[model samples]
Target chain A: MKYEILEHTADLKIKAYGKSLEELFMNAARGLMSVMYEEESSKEGKEVSDVVLETSGPDKEALLVNWLSDILLESDTRNVYCFDFSIHTINEQKISSTMKCIKSVAKEDVKAITYHGLTIKKHNGKLEATILVDV
Target chain B: MFSKEILQKVQKNIWEIPKSYREDMCVPARVFASERMLDDITTDRSLEQLVNVSTLPGIQEFAISMPDIHEGYGFPIGGVAALSVEDGVISPGGVGYDINCGVRLLKSKKTVKDIESSIVDLANQVQRDTPSGVGRGGELVLSQDEMDELLEGGVPWIIKKGYGLEGDEEFLEQGGRFDEADSSLITDHAKKRGRDQVGTLGAGNHFVEVQKVHEVLDDEIAQTFGLFKDQIVVMIHTGSRGLGHQVCTDYLRVMVQAMAKYDITLPDRELASVPFLSKEGQEYFKAMNAAANFGFCNRQVLTHLVRGSWKQIIDKKEDLSILYDVGHNMAKRETHDGKEVVVHRKGATRAFGPGHPEIPKQYQSVGQPVIIPGSMGTFSYVLAGTNESMKQSFGSTCHGAGRRMSRKKAKKVIDYNKLKQELDEYHVVARAGSARGLVEEAPGAYKDIDDVVNVVQETGIAKKVVKLKPLVVVKG
Candidate 1:
């Protein structure tokens, strides 16, 4: 999968294209974490039990926010890295997914998820997601 | 759009964007800015954000932005808007992520000359005593029960614990406590995030600077705040730390649902809000107040820690006291526009006029103290509110030397060693856990605070009391 970061804002932006929903969601989460955490310092660890999330937004932009919000919410609340997620459903208004959290107490933490560059669109027949994380 | 094309000049230093900007907009967007800063910042998304903010339900006559405005999440960093309490909307975006992140100023009887030789020792003491940087915890750890009380009691609780002075509380805005805070509205997770974070100087633009009162512009107001020329003072800039951030994030999820429940339609989802009288809105206010109180309490506790550092570093028996504490990112139920409105000021400080009920009796003749910190190694400001600000910005003023360069950009352009050398030349003793942090916060990365303060002072929004030059800096 490959992604592009849009110009600038306090919140980060990334457009990821992948062959599978799991790959795309994983890349998107990775993109958001890079802004708050020193990505160079992150480590892969023992995987925790799988957790599923389901949320429905009124539109794709809201859907993307809900998707990422669920991942981040899980991280802060659970105190673990939500390393990956596989989307079972991706629609304009709803999503269902199974996510894996790196089950370790983390040294890094995200302060908040910002509403900067928060939008979802399709470009060149590929899904694009841009979101902001407030650290 | 924040296009001045739609704005009508009602008077000097005030511009209005009518309600016609959008159908959902409850009122116009009012801006408090110099013609120059307005022109410079409005070209970006900040103005559009202001207009979007104006569209929030129950927003009063206008949404407003301060002179030191910049693009931010939902509201402009220096944005202010009040919603009719009975009908207006409440938004987490309006208060920002850091919650009650604010500034507290403390004055010392000693002159700058008296402590000139001990600058390094004082800074080292502060860094050692005051918790700072990412993932740091301070000496104060509130149990679940204590945090609940702290949320409601605010600075008074801190003072009770021997953190501040009786005179200090009398001078604080709202006596440094937000009364509406409902502990029930805060989640266990949020309380946990904040529990160990009290007295901490969080990362990013957060700082604690020991400064000297270099100039006093208003003798009466300066005297009211116990500020004197050459007097040494310290400014602690921080907020509810991790807890507030968690609260805002927690509420944003609920707000998104609230928008749909209220059938509120908006151009941006980030502008999600619920009518102020709605259950969700009231809960947000309660929770936000709790967070704001947490922020207030956090600063209060920090004041105590700093006092400890000062007494030990300089002289154990020397007297040290607080001047004023002000919240920057907060929402309050206040009277404005001849009505009760819920005003949300994110990255803007409340500057209530002298006689406002919120200000304590001791400052009835001088208004609230508004401490605007400069970037590291720069001059800080002390301004007093004017009735004009009360009439104009829901009693608010510019918060700080708004950033001109991104931290990433600053780190690239400002060499850490050179910046340190330049600061040393100014006799600004400094200590930081990270050299990278020093570079990211280079004074060159921000607008000249002198310029920002002059505009606010000249506009009569707030009168300058004194200017503070850094004596020593401690970063976290």
Candidate 2:
């Protein structure tokens, strides 16, 4: 599993796992998308649009927050559901990705990606991070 | 890792964790809650978050938490910190993502009997008039220039546009507008998200509730606020919607980078900070004020919509005047103990005491009316700020019942159909956007509001004025 929902009292928290840094970023995006649209059931006649997202920060943790924040803002402002995150390039400070998005209204709103207790770590040959999202 | 044993009882309902508890803490961490409430409080990381707040530069006296304090990202919800403007730092995390997420009380002359027959229709009418639910936009759309003007002008702009009744702005904090707001400082992305969200009640604990004055605890103060027993009133609980959220997200990134330059280190990155006088800090302060203005204007537009709903179902001539509008998430300049400080109230309401210059003139004599909204299908309260609060808690009090359970736990334990049936049994006409949303906000997820309020009253921070029970609840 790329991500699993963690119990939080107020906001939403998720732990995403990846085999590599690029995979970690992709999985984090997927985790965010899963929360916004819980049921990934149908895709009939949905408008498909190709879009690229790029964000850079001082470090990996900040980069992950900015990346998810970019996706959240794009979803809210454009009213589109982002899915299938395809990371073309990623580093400790920057990430670039192209995703196939569907023209569907979001089922919910994830307000912001927070850096509270955020740390990217390697464990048992897998990269993982616990992200707190303000909903 | 916090436990009840480490805390020392300061008074009847106040407890303190001295600065000795943590080597990094600059001051003590104080909490206002009864002994019984400590069991629930220690179960979360809220106290540790409070300790983190104590370590912030230039924080005054002690870091304070109200009875409703709950674990949030950086600062705990229901946390209050007073920082010296000259040396203190402004953290976006301190004000929370939903800037000015607040509550406003609208007083009507009619009693419950007058609107009893139309309760269901009234709830449906309000649900139709106000745009709510997740990711929903309102009918009123603003152009880019108009959006900037709205960000600068706030509630007065709404009044000038004929969206609000005359004298509506007077009852709001800061007269419903912060003059320090600079619309140019607000980012384009924030503007884009907020342009059409002026009259929306965003989901996740936001609502427009029709309540009745079930009990008048203090008749004199209740009368001063134009509330009476059995009187029907409307409470609007919302904030700046997506615009405010984006602003916080934008600044948190900026501050995180700026922190390295300032040589400031914190226990949590979410509590990033820079000196209040720094260039980046000033820019963020201006941008935050702009978002705060947007929050006040959002509620004002919703008030206009709710008024329209009221006229359609009840008497067309019925007048619904704002009793008070209080923002729980904000940072404001205020004087306590003759020293000016920037008070950050994240999930905490500013309850300026009686005769405080910031309060409305009429309410100044009795103190500001602190509107505390309980969880859905629970009893809310109207309390008056007291002088003691200024000395005790920087003129602040609890915001709500505060979450005691996770959303996941609530949904798992609560049956939506049964919850709806319970609301029906209580004569509450509930209009929810989603069944899952309704279950997540189940009253069982929150602490017992009555106990929270009793702690506030016992601490003498705020005096109870009246108790309000919902007649109709429109959940976002």
The number of the candidate with the highest lDDT is 2
Report the C-alpha lDDT of model 2 over B1-476, residue by residue, as the tens digit. 47889999988999999999999999999999999999999988999999999999999999999999999989999999999988999989899999999999998889988988899899999999999998899999999988988888989987898889888899999999999999998889989988889999989999999999999999899889988999999999999899999999999999999899999999999999998889988888999999999999989999999999999999899868999899999988777888888899999999888898889999979999999999999999999999999899999999999999988899899999999999889888889998988999989999999999999999899999999999999987
Candidate 1's docking class is: acceptable
Please list all clashing residue pairs in model 1, or write none if there are none: B58-B88, B88-B276, B101-B239, B133-B476
Candidate 1 residue-wise lDDT, A1-135, digit = tens = 556644333333456665544455667777755544554344545556788998776666656666776676666555566645677877667788887665444433457656666754566666666666565
Residues B291-398, candidate 1, lDDT per residue (tens digit)? Answer: 888887777777878888889878788657777788889888877767898889888998988787777677779887889999999999999888988866778889
**What's the lDDT for all of these models?**
0.77, 0.91
Off by over 4 Å in 2: none
lDDT of 2 at B52: 97
Per-model fnat list: 0.26, 0.85
Compared with the real two-chain complex, what DockQ does model 1 have? 0.37
Model 1 lDDT, residue B45, Cα: 81
TM-score of 2: 0.99
lDDT of 2 at B382: 96
